[model samples]
Target: MKIFDLAAGADGPEPAVATCSRKACRSEASWQLLWNNPKIHTPERRKIWLACGEHRAWLEDYLQTRGLWKETLALVPDTSSAPIGQDF
Candidate 1:
């Protein structure tokens, strides 16, 4: 299944195509890693990192290594729903 933020707003525009966040991996995104840097973002602020199946672990591990990972959640397709105006 795909992943996204449960807290992410569910009524807005979604991209026609999303690519993995991992460098060099152009696969379509199937997961969304929700995270925040306490030093940089507020408590309610959660950032996103989209990942494909192959790079999911690597990207998550990359965040864990930096102690920036908060959680991982699936992004449901077919709804054309996602937080609008969210940027990487």
Candidate 2:
């Protein structure tokens, strides 16, 4: 399921911020870790994990150990008018 921080004053549900993928981490994410399991996912399918500065290396190492890591890049907020949940 998708998890999003609630915008306190908004009438409809809205995303307040993008958070780290690490469990129980509430810090805002600054990096995007791209990965996928070769055994389960196609080569072109990329899965994303958001990571805060403090956890980037840890998350990368975890993925790398499993031979799942593809790349790491700075997180850039999307400005397009695409549907919220379509990409995943």
Candidate 3:
């Protein structure tokens, strides 16, 4: 099976996956923010943050203060259904 298929089938719940937009960061992300970037995404679309655990709290706080917390929370994927990997 293809990677996507395997990923889909071998999972309990789907975790949110996103890529960091930072120039120097290339980490695979599970947390993201729906930020709208006129330079890239359309005005109606929000961008993502793809934050690691270390940055999750910080990022959430920043977004919360901006009144974008609801939007940000909406992007969080449900982990309860995701499969636990051996790495954990």
Q: lDDT-based ranking, best first?
A: 2, 1, 3
**Model 2: per-residue lDDT, tens digit, 1-88?**
2233254343545545668888888798889999998999999999988889999999999999989999999988876534333122
lDDT score at residue 16, model 2, on the 0-100 scale: 50
Q: Please list the Cα RMSD from the true structure of every candidate, rounded to 1 decimal place.
A: 9.8, 5.9, 8.4
In candidate 3, which residue pairs get closer than 3 Å at backbone N, Cα or C atoms, i.e. clash?
12-81, 12-83, 13-81, 13-82, 35-47
Say which candidate scores most in TM-score.
Answer: 2
What is the per-residue lDDT of model 3 for residues 2-84, given as tens digits with 9 covering 90 to 100? 67676667653355445443445555556565555355555676555656555666766876776554354433444564542
lDDT of each: 0.77, 0.79, 0.53
Candidates by TM-score, descending order = 2, 1, 3
lDDT tens per residue, model 1, 31-64: 8899889898998999999889999999899999
The TM-score obtained by model 2 is 0.74
Please identify which of the two predictions, 1 or 3, would achieve the higher lDDT against the true structure.
Answer: 1
TM-score of each: 0.71, 0.74, 0.38
Clashes of 3: 5
RMSD of 2: 5.9
Instruction: State model 2's lDDT.
Output: 0.79
